[model samples]
Target: MSSPSPKSPELSDHSKKYDRQIRLWGEHGQKSLERANICLINATAVGCEVIKNLILPGIGSFTIIDGNIVTEEDLGTNFYVEKEAIGASKSECCMRLLQELNPDVNGDYLDESIDSLLETRSEFFQSFDVVIASNIKEATLKNLSNLLWDYNIPLVYCRSLGFVGSIRLQFREHCVVEPHPDNKPLDLRIENPFTTLKEHLAVSEVNGKSPWVHVIHKHLVEWKKDHEGNPPKTYKEKNQFKEMIRIAMKSDEENHEEAIKAVNTVFESAGKISSNLSAIFNDEACQKLNTKDKNLQFWVIAKSMQDFIKTENNDLLPLQGVVPDMTADTDSYIKLQSIYRQKAMQDAENVYQRCLNTLLNIGMKNEIISENTVRLYCREASGLRFIRGTKIQSEYSDWDKSTTLAEGLECQQPLMELYAVLRAYDHFYTEFGYIPGESYVEPDTPKLKGLVTKLLQDWNIRHPVSDDMVYEICHYGGAEIHSISAFIGASAAQEVIKLLTQQYVPIDNTFLYSGITTETATYKF
Candidate 1:
């Protein structure tokens, strides 16, 4: 069959189907989503829910690893497994049902245990983009976490137990060029306009029809003349600057109003290097860009940007090529937009060349970092983020000595108490052959309390887990409620999407959700 052209109607329809999300993350992010291959460790209720959310968004494919068979309990808690699927392989049943959500998504399942896969065919996991594990034992989870951490693949470990759920993201390092932060101001560079922008503004007239950029530039030029060639630097001066704009308004012009509103932010540290970006540039990874590892692409680009800032760019980050909408004539708006767009393209091209030069010097392929990727990185350079994550196994091994946990408990946070109880539950399950509340809630309450007490003592924490909290957990009996599972499933899937697309910032390390109070918290351990 012949391939569809770029203007094909079929491609348009495909884009239209995901138009809403495409608007959020752009076409490149959508392509990343469609190219991802997710590995789900178990087909439990929460696990299937995570898969459902990812599949609906048209992920490339998924592989479910499970050795259990579907049972009556699964039908009650899990939405993917139907009643007729009883006695069938749980992973296979889930794969068949979930594939029905999006035919574009491919899926398969191994009716084998994850432990067996880890021991016998561990390399099979190398192909996946992200791994989601649910309802896994601590011992097995540690092995898997260690393995994936060594491989530098992100692992979304989550559990939905009764009314509470938690997710811990484990990875070696992750970098984001686009964090999609809200209320990012337009980088107009009015304070320090480039040659083209200065030429455009020099000829532009300030009137009711003028764009806000011109209006602000005109008033700013006048303000600088009267204030010793300086913009407003103090709070009172800024307010006075706004007053100047308000008093100079010939009428109730929208552009003038926008100028007054923009006075506070437009001149506030324009063309300054943010502390976060400065930190990124100074990071060891960015400093040591001579390595041959392809994973250092973000740092390599960052190093190139640093060099650009130091040499060619006059110590300023790349210009973000975007402008705000305001009341203006079509010609005026187009002219202003063109000036900024051209400057941005020039900056991006400069950065892209530096990246190519660095890659060649480091003995890597120049094509490893494409022009489009560099453009995207330069466009979102101000909002770039880098996260270095610790393994889940380390969290477990050092749980008792965690000062973050200690401080949360000292503050009498309910979620902290829940965290302790969950740890105790894990200890109970490992020591005994069953979950604490699996068969009997009343008899196991004391045992769970004892385990929590021992943990606190070992950690030397003075805060105590109350009896009521223990009873509450015992009452849950380790049962998986669909509502809680659904909530956690959606949250986990969102984090997975962030990881796959490398767009928005994922949680720093851990996220805890409590259905009882309808509140959530993020913790970095």
Candidate 2:
């Protein structure tokens, strides 16, 4: 489509509300982001930080589920729950504050524990587009994971313990149509332009005031005719082609330099697939994606595109749906741009229809693939990219992943020893009524230190944690640090957007970050 006119009356309120983000990802991605209904299981600092980010971006709706009453400790951790809300419901306090960030975004609150909600109103979890669970118990998280897995919904598990944070992403096999790869290959279809584009260029004659683009197009047709429809294949032939364009220039003409400059583009034969595209087409995932698959949007677009190419019998990829700048007159440039854009838009529509048919054949419906989705897919046809995250089953069963995860132990940056201490703390919290250490009360440092060692041994981690580090973490009693929560919350929110919009690569399976030293690591099972 042509550039949106600044004064156009067709722009929607959504476009105004999300103007900046719409520029980052296209209107389609913004729409996807706006359509999401996110759920946060806890109203802690990390959770509120994530929700704050999403609320400002105008997500469709969000539900905060927390049954605990706000306490003095909670006030110190979460910014939204002020001292005035000390005895109020955690979910209600956070919901009120987060909703004020953006009135356009809808908000809901369930003043009940996630375990009770899962037991009584289990269907409540299925309606959300994605779920974010933070600071949940191990058994509760496992139950939530299994439920979300059954429903095929994505879940981002986040945790922030004082100075360190970690994240784990779980979803069914996912695909990304537009991972927004850098270094997009040149998409010039000069070798074999589409019918409308070819016809437009065939009769589009060059005048004295015509741009250098017309000069190149005129010689391109002549060279093809002379060489039996073959472009210059080798370096020698390319230079010979350039010399031909140079010889055609008028010596006395003031614009002879423009015609001579057309030589640089005359030999650019680059409309075919790149090595990445070749690999994508031959991917085992692409080969095996069929009726019983997850019905991801990317795979649907890709399979429909395969059908589109097969029917056309043309090996060229779909148009990138772009028009580069040229030295043409205003009218000439618009006309030239329209020719390519119209073909690309038409090709996208064709792909959309084929996608409907593919869905129908697989016992699905047209609603499975939106028109905007297919349109963006075709616009990025040459730039089609996909990423598959590690399965939760694999993350649970993979024993070899310990070596990779253990790399965090090598860095003394902040000491990953807290990971084990937290697990032990959780064990203590479950068995006892309170956490390892409490404020204004003497800390049980000796008992907690012993629990930390036992927990470390249970996990097969050989890292030797110092007595002081364990004491400090326990002494702090896992109170939320605003700086750590701010950074990790923003990071998790970014990943959630990527997953919802399928615009960029999300966290693989695990991410370990230390704000103390700004050290980060990403791992896969």
Candidate 3:
């Protein structure tokens, strides 16, 4: 297709109500959600979070299947149930609150449990595109997993105890995941809630030591620089300063030199104010990322480069492909694409190398940077590639090898270098204090042109570029730290944009975790 179907008109209310979440998922994902018809088998706390997430993304319609009623305990965790709502049907109450979030949603509340529905209305789940079960028993979950599996519907099973949450995704027959080479038992150590909670509460901010406190100092210094007389006192003014830095980073479309300069000025000024302030932005924890693995590096650079693009532009766009109404001859098109395509690949490698070097300088081991265990993604983003003939038998194979551009590629180094520099500032500031060059911008289509410019060069690759090829990495839970969650979400979401937009080579079932260290390994199942 030359262009995506014209987007549905923006709903002002929805835009504001779901502002934060919409910023997370992007418009295309939101559109996928709008076209989605979902089913939730239960309405418990975890399920409620999932529903809230979906509703905020503007799901087209949903069937909430539950027979349970609200209880006093539910009121503590679920936002939907009020004191008056106790004893009312949980699904019904949830539906009402969801409506308040987005009236565009079509909701159906079932006051019957899954067992009852199975007995009387086996087809209850048939209409939904995806089904989520929360507030359900283990046996019920297994049973529903089987049912959803048989019916070819995607099912999400979630449970939470205090601070820890667990989610398992079960898909139907056609869906297959490459299993881990040495299939080990699923890690079932339910984290100790008290220990985790205690750890969170136990941490104290040392003047220049804590990340957030340093940010406070950075903002204060910036305020002092700009406003002259008195510095910020109220939480709101401090917040405004923080926001100003964020907005300044994303306001431009190219690079963020000014943003970088402003942050440095703030950091320098803070140093003069207090010894602790000087220690804040210079924390040892901050390390530049590595680019030897081109993919990782590209992500770092892409984030830094596109911060402004995402903030300034809102259109769903692509960097390369058949331009609308193009009349250039085939030869001319090929020649034009070759120039940009080569540049795209070159750019990817350059960014990757840059990020790699940065990480190494900050302390990441060179061995980890070069190991194939950590995929250096550096091609046009596309879908999770399944091997042409991988059978969906009971046993699964390593599917990562199959999920790539039909033609394999070699690593590009220069692009890696560029990626590292861009990422270093963000990592440095995040560890030290204050927002360095970071910006909060929603991902959009037009920003993708630069990467796709590379894909057009390799026309000989067997895989044809299409929307279905675009991939999205799924995240079910947050990391140990709250701030890390944003980083994780943004990283995963950016990959999805590349996957969907076919701006890079796709990674299949790529799992990225960094709680302890950056450990990346490809798994299928």
Candidate 4:
């Protein structure tokens, strides 16, 4: 008798709970999220909203740091605290409510002000994977930014006041393995096939009835014969090449039609390095591999890739091991896909060996990087990203030398104007111990405008902040609108997830949202 068929494994509780999100980021990314320890400063509406989203996604744990007691105003803006919770610790209230969202997520609170924490237990901040600061004062923000920069911890500084909000991401350097870009083209290697791929294509039966990839390969080979062994490089040449495929169509087959459609993009992108990937390869970090620092695993793998390209791979990134769907029989498609997969596996193995050799050359333990991790890096080599962040202190200290701000003012961009007003609002709060319009909008308009003028002058910007914008800022009176907080908070949470999982691309540095215009913009400092 045949052995009993093995039953398919069932989903674990953790996987079942986060099934939807696991689908989004995959189990690897979900595990990263589940292992993350997030630290949030302040339990303001925006801050709670940020944690609320994170809690639902099953982040391992979170610590809320806020010394303030909840007030009636807090009740209006924050949904996490109730009337009974008034006069209680804001951090505790937020933690209690947020923890209820996901039992799998562990949470705690520190009823201490940020300034106090920085003074006494600054090292405490270093323990977290990421820190989210909301509605913090400018001086406090600079201090926290500097502290975290030294610790090399990523900080998401966000604020939601009135109808405008902004988020600034501060990190020394961040590397992303899987950007999960949309509609990424297949890596067919048609233009520059490897030995295995070329061998397969040479032997595969080629006809209109076969897969489009095989058809394209057959035609590309013939096209290369008459064109000095080079695939069509010019626009006119490509078009001529497409016409050649069109003429070879037999009885208007769908595979031939698909082949014709792919002619434009297939050769253009095949065997070419994207500018973004090229930039990553040329980055200073990748150029200078510091073997002493065990944490520089991304750069280590990147250096291995560089070496692999030079020595074994012939100056090309590893095959992505993917093929796009095309008109073809199941058997033909599977056979072609297996060839690509086999080549991809071999390339990954080569790079993995190189990584191991690099690690040993530096007298480091090979266990510092796992073989599985190296394979992941090789799979995502083409989409690798590295971000070098600027400190918030630098942006404030070097306002005069900022050409991006100057250009934005000259162009009269609405978001840039809003950014100016927000800076002036911070100044007003610092000088007067309250926001401009907290008491009365009409009385604070000129005062706020004066601060805006001073800020513009400091930056050497000749542009003026419109009176209408100043009035709008004062009318909001530093009040945190719940809806706006939720919007910005959700957005910030998304950025935080990107940082934690290192999957999707996070914003370069700054994200600005205007509730009035219902628009958002990102800028690099």
Candidate 5:
């Protein structure tokens, strides 16, 4: 096991330092990034490049394992390795340089190769939150992939060859909270106002401070009480609801734009739960959150919220604890905001203790969850997002579509040809112990031609890959190009930040970057 790291700076410190990013991803996402421990294997130019990005953003810690001695070639691309460090171990060189970027980002390095570590202490792999392995053999990558797969850890397999670079993520499953959705779900609860809100609206006297919002809410409550306590359901009933608002409006209140807007806007299909919330109710994770698993606060809270939705007469998700800016006076708006916020907190607390009982039922220890976690989940309950990713291994075995996939490729879409070559590249390196032309001084077209042909046959693909494409790859001498490595490194680092913070959607299974044309393409298998 790795040694413990110092706690990341507190939220107050985060606000002072990470103010900009906190605005972008919110404090919750910043916390996730700060808590994540990333592991990288082989500190090649690409690996260090990725590490560089994460360190700058203040990831909690990182551990790099590499056994190679730095060479003159390392100085060409790896910014982290200076000329003075040419003879040094690549892992140590990369770590020293990366630490200089962010003192808060604690890290260590292992001088042994990944293969040696895998042989002796494979369980050590389980200690990381995510793994980035670059410039590795296929068998070794697959071993790491499968090991991490079983443990539910995300594995980023990145490669850079010549002008081609690609990153394939092997994640069994991952859930993201901050999708940065364009449309944020709101928990207005307009149709089914809570007891407190209803009681506030029940008064006939507004004391001249009531905003048009309260006027409209009060009018609608009076109408519902006179009727069967249901909001407008049909077209005529909506018209009827509007008429009720119109009647409640005094002649001078006609100029009250808030009242006018509420009449036209507020009553449209107000009673039912949102379609998004309904979809959330159908999610398998919420349904499957039983006694066996109580570790995830989100899931545990979601499970409890599910029960709340079922049992509550409102039949709605919990209060989102938010009130929109209104036309009310300062006191009225603040009062309304406090009501919503306080009710949401009460609802949240009920779910929190309910889920705590669930944790106990699942045999969890005391205080396995915190009230703050429950509060966060409840506040974002309506805006909660779910993502289900396809497994990375699914992409490798689907080569039968290579013909169709290649057909979609316009001539010299280096990206299209790069994927094919990468597959064949894996085959060549595994059998020959080196990339296609890396060991030879001259272009080994014949050797490469045979390998490509064998790879196509194995995949049962008959599509023709131009001979020029094969030669171009061979001309690269199966060597990592500086610009290409840098591109993949930056891209991988961005995705890792997304993966850890989950603020933005991470690239789905595979991303191919071609320096030949400076473009990237995404594919799902």
Candidate 6:
């Protein structure tokens, strides 16, 4: 396991500040953000907004470039600048404001436009960890894109108009673009064993004596066992409770007996206890409600529960004094405890969504064809202006229809299993757990001999492996998973974090915007 990050002086005082987000991205992700250095080419209003979000998370360092002074209009929309600072240079003002959000960040501001310096300097852009150009002219966009691309540096291109915004991210190579080795798929990491139990408890239409309701019903069973199988607590709490039960139990004492009233009272009391516990478990305080608050309240609760649940080890009474804060009674404790389990499930779902989103968005951000790869191919053969590849074929095949990896490989007719192999390589590095230079099967080699035999039998192609040619096809011909639409920009930023910090693998080359509709398919490069 990787050692924990050294306690940074930049820690926040609040625990709940990012509670919901922390559950999604985890503390390691937050630390990855802390160690990133990002560059903003033009600090426009939209750029400032993106920076505001980035700064709050305390991205490692920022270099902002702009020559324009802040105008009065900026005060209305730019959250980082004040009305009084209208005449000041926007870059410096934004830098100062961002630094106030987190003292750990080191921000630099340039009072001159990016255009003026580019004419005489080529090394200026090389200083940043990642380059993000916001609201720049199209010509400048192309120039910056080319510069970053030539240098193999990751680039983020963004544009905004009114409510609509577009963002693009580019990572130069697979090694730098992929996720960390330790990261796992969000879904697998969060599947819970107690889902059915939690769901049954939450259901209102359950039979009173169902096996699923045992957690609550067991209270009665335990109480009865404690009272020598005679329900002594009910008798002690209320004589009416026991007398009515006794009368109801006898065959000759049922003439106008009010047993229903006694039964209702007992249920009402149990219901109250259940609600109290539910309140505590569902409590906003218990959820650690904010990521901005970095006080680690969840860890505190987890630690306390570790101790509180220990009484069960000694076979001692648990419900008497084992109540969580604010859950004073057994019913409340039970309900809150149930809520806690539900919240755990919710937290896991959120993490899965974040990871899934991040995986897809990385592809959308780098929607450009690999110019370097194209150039390499061009050098091998003269007059190769048009490369007969899957991406180009798909573009001309239908009116924006998605292409499959198998089809792409068929069209290319390469000397190897190009697309399939690339996918395997991508999966191996990102989610399937494989690293380069490690002793194992050839990169992208089938994991099982049975599957290999089956695929070879079906495809009628058998090739011996453990060579570099297979690895190249697997790495390059693979599809990219793209995250599109509303989450485009956020996903771009997430990918940059992974690339810069080497904490997460980049997503496959597939742009999926299922938000508009559940229609998701492949986008090849």
Among all windows of 10 consecutive residues in model 3, the one with the lowest summed lDDT is 468-477
Give each prediction's root-mean-square deviation over alpha carbons. Answer: 4.0, 5.3, 27.2, 3.3, 7.1, 22.1
Models ranked on TM-score:
1, 4, 5, 2, 6, 3
Please provide, for model 3 over 423-460, each residue's C-alpha lDDT reduced to its tens digit, 9 standing for 90 to 100. 22223333434222123212311122222323333323
TM-score of each: 0.96, 0.78, 0.38, 0.95, 0.78, 0.38
* Models sorted by lDDT, best on top: 1, 4, 2, 5, 6, 3
Residue 341 lDDT in model 5?
92
> What are the per-residue Cα lDDT tens digits for candidate 4 across 1-525?
112245958999877888899889999899899899999999989999999999999999999999999999987889999899889898998899889998999999999999999999899987899999998888898899899988889999989988899999998888888889895666788888888778888898977558887888888889889988998888899888888888888786888888878877787665456787788778877777776542478877888888888887777888878877776777777777788888888888888888888878777788888878888887777778887778888887666455787798889888888888988888888898987888888888999999999988887788887888889988988789999999999999999999988889999888999999998999886
lDDT of 6: 0.45
TM-score, cand. 6 vs. native: 0.38
Candidate closer to the true structure by TM-score (higher is better), 2 or 4: 4
lDDT of 5 by residue, 186-262 (tens): 45566677888877766635533466667666666777887789766677776676676666656555324455455
| TM-score of candidate 1 versus the correct structure, residues matched by position | 0.96
Candidate 1 lDDT, 1-525, residue by residue in tens: 111224634558788889888888889889999999999999999999999999998999999999999999887899999998899899999999999999999999999999999999999999999999998888899999999987778999989999999998998888877888776756788877888999999998888888999988988899899999888889999899899888889866988888888887887656677777888988877888747454678888888888988998778778887887777877788788788888999999999999989888888888778888888888888878887888899877866446887899989888888888888888888888788788888899999999999988888787898898898888888789999999999999999999988888999888888899998999887
lDDT of each: 0.87, 0.74, 0.42, 0.85, 0.73, 0.45
* TM-score for predicted model 5 compared with the true structure: 0.78
Error of model 3, residue 497, in angstroms: 12
The clash numbers for all candidates, in the given order, read 0, 0, 44, 0, 0, 48
Best by lDDT, which number? 1
> Which lDDT tens digits does candidate 6 get at residues 227-346?
565433443544544453444344433211223233334333221122323343345543443333222222223222323323222211112111123212334435544554454444
Q: In angstroms, how far off is 480's CA in candidate 5? A: 4.1
lDDT of 4 at 496: 94
Please identify which of the two predictions, 1 or 6, would achieve the higher lDDT against the true structure.
1
Pairs of residues at least 3 apart in sequence or in different chains that clash in candidate 1: none
- lDDT at position 50, candidate 5: 86
lDDT of 2 at 448: 77
Give the Cα error of residue 313 in candidate 4, in Å: 1.6
For candidate 4, what is the lDDT? Answer: 0.85
Poorest 10 consecutive residues by lDDT, candidate 5: 264-273
